[model samples]
Target chain A: MAGAPNQASLVERLVFRGTRIAALVILVVLVAPMIVIVPLSLTSGTLLIYPLPGLSGRWYEEFFTERLWVQATWNSVLIAVPTTVLATTLGTFAALGLNRLRSRLVPAVAVFLITPLIVPVIIYAVSAFYFYSRLGIVGTYPGLIFGHTALAIPFVVVTVNATLKNFDANLLRAALVLGATPRQAFARVTLPLILPGVLSGGLFAFITSFDELILTLFVASPEQRTLPRQLWSGVQETINPTIAAAAVVLMLVSVLVMLLAEWLRRQGRRIQGKQ
Target chain B: MERADRRRELVGWLLVAPSLLFMAFFFAVPIGAFLLRSVDNTDLVGAMPRTMAEIGGWNGQDLPDESLFMALGEDFTALPDITAAASLGRRLNHNLTGYRSLVMRTFTGLRRHEGPLGREALIAIDKRWSDPAHWRVIQQERSWLTPLYLLASLDLERGPEGIRTIPPERRLFVDLLVRTAWISIAVTLLCLVLGFPLAYVMASSGPRLSSWMLVLVLLPFWTSLLVRTTAWIVLLQRNGLVNQVLERLGLIDAPLTLIYNRLGVYIAMTHVLLPFLVLPLYSVMKGVGGDLTRAAAGLGAPPSTVFRRVYLPQVMPGIIAGCSLVFVLALGYYITPALVGGPRDQMIAHFIAYFTSTSVNWGMAASLAGILLLMVVVLYAALARLVGLDRLKAR
Candidate 1:
C-alpha cells in the first residue's frame, strides 16, 4: 500500500511538470515572431534576405528623411482625427437613443448599426466610388472622411453600449426627482459614467481610419494618399526596408494607444462592478 | 399636454436623423447605382441611335445590306467633332476586348477620310470591319439597356443571339467567392478553438490572473496590422528564429516552407483576429456564474462532464457571436493575404480591388460586390436564426 501511494505521487509530480512546460512552449511559440523582427529590422543590409549581415539604423533614418513617407503620415492623421471625432459624437448620441428605447427594438437597432461592420469592406468601397462619383464627392476630403466615419461608428456603438449596460436607471430617476432636467442629468450623471467607453471607442475609430486600406483605395487620389495607401503602393511597386521602418513606427503608436484603451476599459469595469 | 410628449418624440428622431440620412445618401444610393450599372446599357445603341434605327430592319444573321452600311458610313462621317466617334469607340470597347484601341485608331483614320459615304471609305478606315461578324455584334447590342454586361459579370455573356456561360478559364469570381467563404469559416473556427480556452481562463480565474491575461490579449489589438503581418514574415522565413530553433533541436533536416503559403495566411490571420473572439466571449462569460458548474460537479458528475453539460451550454451564445463576428471580418481581409499568402490563396477582396483599380471593369466589380453582399446577408440571417444575437450580449 505504501509503495502504491508513493508511485501515484511521483506520477502526479511528472504530470504537473509537463503541463507547466507545455504552457511555456505555447507562450514562446506565440511570441517568437515579435522577437525575430526586432533583430531583423536592425539589419545593416539593403535587402531583407535572411542571415542579416550586421546592424544599422539607416532604414529608420531614410524613413524620416523621405518626403513621401512624411506626407503620407500627415495625411493619415488628417483623415483619422476628424473621423474619430465624428464617429464618437454620432455613436454616443446613437447609443443614448438606443438605451432609451425598449429592449425589444434594441437588437434590431444594433444589427442596423453593425451592418457596416458585417459587410465586406471591398463591396462598400466599390459602391462608395460610384455613389461618390454621382454626388461629385469622390476623391475629396469629405468623401473619405465620411466613409471612414461610417466604418468607425460601429466600434463606438458597441463599446459605448457595453459601458451603458452597468448603468443604473435609478440615478436618472433620482436626478429627475431632484429638479435636474433630462439634459443636465445626462451630462452630469450618464456622460461621466460612460466617458471611458467613449474614449476607448474613439481610439478604435482612430485606429480604423488610420489603418484603412480598401476604402482609401477607392476614395483617395494620389494627392490624398494616406499612410496605409502609400505603404500598399510601395509594397506593390517594390520591396524596400523603408516599409519595415514604417511598420515599426506604426506598431509602436498603435500599441501605445491600445494600452491606453485597455487601461481605460479596466478602469470602467472596476467602476461598474462597484456600482 | 400631449404636445410635450410629441415634442420629445420629435427631438428623438431629430437626434438620429443625420446618421440615418447620411447612410441613405452615401451608403444606400451607391449600392443602388452599382445595381443599376449591372443592367445599364449606355453603349452601342445609345452612342449611335440614328445609325441603330437605320440598321434596325437588317437581320444580323446575314451580312448587313449595302444601304445600311452606307447609312452607318454617312452617320460616322456627319459627326461634327472627333469626340462623338471617340465616344462610340469607347462604348464598343466594353463589349469586346482590344476594341478600345481599335476604336481610337479608327477614329483617327475617320478624321482623315475625305471621300463620300461608300465602300471605299469603309475599307479605307479599317479592313477588320469588312468581316460581317463585327457588324453583327454592333447590330445585336443596339439596345439602350443591355443584360449583356450583367450576364457577363456572372460568368455568363450574351453573344449575337443568346446568353451563355463564360469559358471555364474566365469563370474566376465565383470560385473566388467560394474560396473567400471557406477561408473566413476556417479563420472563425480557428479563433473559436484558440479563444475559447483563453476566454474561459480569463472568466474563471482570480481577478489578478485574469487582468494580466487580459492585458496580453489586448496588446496585439493596439499594434498595426501591417506590423503584425510583417512580424510573421520575419519569423516564418527560411532562416528566421522559428526555423533556427527547430533546426537546433533537430526537429527537421531543413527549414520548412512556411511564409507565402496558406499555412502562413492562417497563422497571421488567426493571430490578428483572435482578440475579436476573446473580447465577445469574455463579456458573455463574465456574466456566467461558476456555481452552475460546481453544482453539477457536486451532483456526482466529473469535471469534464460538468464543463460540457453546464458551462458549455451557457457559453454557446458567446461562441456563436464571436465566431460570426470574426468570420465576417476574415472574409474581407485583403492586405494580410496579399502579403503573406501565395497567388492562389488571394481572396475575393483582392480581385474586387483589381477590377476597380487595375482592370477598370466597374460592371464586373459591382457584380462581385453584389455577390459578396448577398453572402454576408445570408450568413447573418443564418446566425440570427441559430443563436439570436440578443442572447449573445452580456446579461
Candidate 2:
C-alpha cells in the first residue's frame, strides 16, 4: 500500500465516478423500459402510460378471453413447439458433424448457414412470400413453421457448436473401448453430457420462433396469426392497455426461457470444470 | 484402410446433409429466385406475343406500321377482357407510366369494334398510340429480359439514347439509400458514445460486479424485441410517460413531440442496438486490461494521453466489429422505424416491404433487396480485409 501510492489523482477519480454513474444510468435505461411495462399493464386506465389511473383486471381478462388473442397464442405455441424440435435436432446434428469434419471450409459453411441472422428479415419475408405462394403454402401453418425453423436453426447451431468445441473426444473413445457400440456410446455418454447444450439451444429456438414477427407477418394467415403478429397489428391500430397486457405475458415467457438458458449454460460449465 | 476412411467421410457428410439440403431449398433457392426476378421480364412478351414480335422489326424513330398495330389488335382480342388488359397495362407501366390504363381502354374499345384493326384505327382508339415515346416503351420491354427494375432501383433509367439519372422530382430511391446510411452512421456513433464507458467499467470492475453488469446487458438481449419497442412507445409518445414526467416536473408547459419522428427512431434504435456494441467492446477491453494504462501513467503520461495512445488503439478491432454490426443491422431495420417513424422518416426497408406486399411489384422489390444485399456484402468484405473473418465468429 505504501509502495503503490494513489496513482489516480482527484480529477481522475472524479471522472471515474462520473463514468460509473453514467454506466448505471445506461443500465437502467436498458432494463427499465422492459420492466416498466409490468406495472403499466396493470393500470386500469385505457391508455398505455405511467401513473396508474386505478387497478383492474380488464386488460388481462381481454388477453385471456378474446378470441383473436387466444387463437394467436395457440398458433404461436403450435408453431414454436415444432420449430424448437426440428431446428434443435437438425442444428445439433450439423454441429456434431462440423465438430468432426476437419475441413478448412467449416467457417464458410457456418457463415452460409447463419445468413438468416446476418441478412435483413425483410429479405427473408419477401423470399418466403414468393416461394410459399408458389407452393400454395402461404398462410398455412406448415409454411410459417418452416420459415421460423430456418431462422432459428442458426442460433441453435451457434450455441450447440460453442458447447461442442470444448468437449473432449476421449470420453466417447473411452465409451467405445468399454465395448459399447458407436450408437450406444453416443446415446449413453455423449448425449447426456451435451444434453444441457441441446436443451438450451431448443429454448433459444423456441423463444426466437415465439417472438418472431416478420416471417409470421409474411407467411401466416388469419388462422395462423402468432402473438407477435397480433401485437404488431395491435400496435399499428391502437396503443392501448391490451397491448401492454400482451407484452407483459410475452415478457414473462421470455424471462423464464432466459433463466432456463442461463441455468443450462452454468450447468454445462460446471460439468466441463469437473473434467 | 482407404475404404474405411472414405466411409468415415461419408458418415460426416451424412450427418450434415439434412440441414444443408433444407437451407438450399428454403433459404438459398428463394433468395436466388428473387434476385433473378430483378432482371427477368417476361410479363409483356407473354401477354402480347404477336405485338412484341411485330414491334421487334419496327424502327425506333416512327410510329409502328399498320402491320404491327394489326398484330397488337389480334393480341389484344386473343386475350381475356379485363384481367389480361389490366395485367399487361400494369407490366408495361413499369417501362412507361400510364400505359396500364391506355392498354385497358384500347382493349375495351377493341372488344366493342366491328371494323379492321390497323394503325389508323389504333390511333383513333387512343391518341397515345400516335406518340412514338409510348412505342419506345413497348419496344424497350419487347424482350423477355430487361434491366429496367435494376436501373430504376438506383434512380436511373435507360432511354432512347443511353442510361441517365431519373428526373430530379422523381428521384427517390437514392435519397432513401443516403438517408438510411446517414441514420445508421448516426446510430452507430450514438451507441459508441453511450456504450464505450459502460463496456470499460464492466471490463475494469471486479468479477462479481462485472458479471452483474453482464446480466443487466443480457436481460435486454433476452427480452423480446417487440416488447422493448413497445416499451419505447410508452415512454416516448406524446401522451406517454416521458412527456408526463417532464410536465410533472414543470420542465415545460406542453409535452414534447417525441414519438413518430427521426428523434424517436434514434432513441429507440440506440436503446435496442446498444447491447450489441457493449458486449463486443467489453470482451475486447476485458482482454487488454488497465496494466498498460497504469504503466503509461507511471511513465509520466497524462491519463487522457494514456487512454488515447495506449487503450484506444488496442480496441480498434472491437470498435470496427461493433460498428459494422450495428451499422449493417441499422440499415436493414424494418419494425422499429416502421412503428415509430413518420412518413418522411421511413427507411429503404419500409419501401421494400411496401413494393412487395402492397404494390405487388416483385421486380422492384427484388431490385431494392439486391441493392441492400450488395451494400452489406461489400461492407463485410471490407471488414474481412481489415479484421480477419474468423474474428467475427468470436463475437
Can you give the TM-score per candidate against the true fold? 0.84, 0.96
DockQ of 1: 0.41
Q: After superposition, how far is residue B4 of candidate 2 from its true place, in Å?
A: 2.5
DockQ of each: 0.41, 0.73
Residue A268 of model 2, lDDT score = 93
Calculate candidate 2's fnat. Answer: 0.67
**Candidate 2 ranges beyond 4 A from true positions:** A1-8, B389-395
Writing each residue's lDDT as its tens digit, candidate 1 over B1-395 gives 67776665566556555665666666667777876666666755655666688767876666666777677776676666777777676667767766666666666776677766666667677776677767766776777777665566567777645777878987866677788888888989888877876777677678997777776766676676767777777677776567887888999899998988999999999888888888889889998997887788667565557767998888888898899879878887888999889998998788777877887666667666666677778888898777655555534
Mind listing the fnat for each candidate? 0.40, 0.67
Q: What is the C-alpha lDDT profile of model 2 across A133-245, one tens digit per residue?
A: 99898999889888999999999899889988888889989999999999999898888778899999999999999999988888888989999999999999988988999
Per-residue lDDT over A25-123 for candidate 1, one digit per residue giving the tens place of the 0 to 100 score:
433444555555666667798765567899899888887888999889998999999999998988877777776654465667677776787778788
Model 2 pairs whose backbones collide:
none
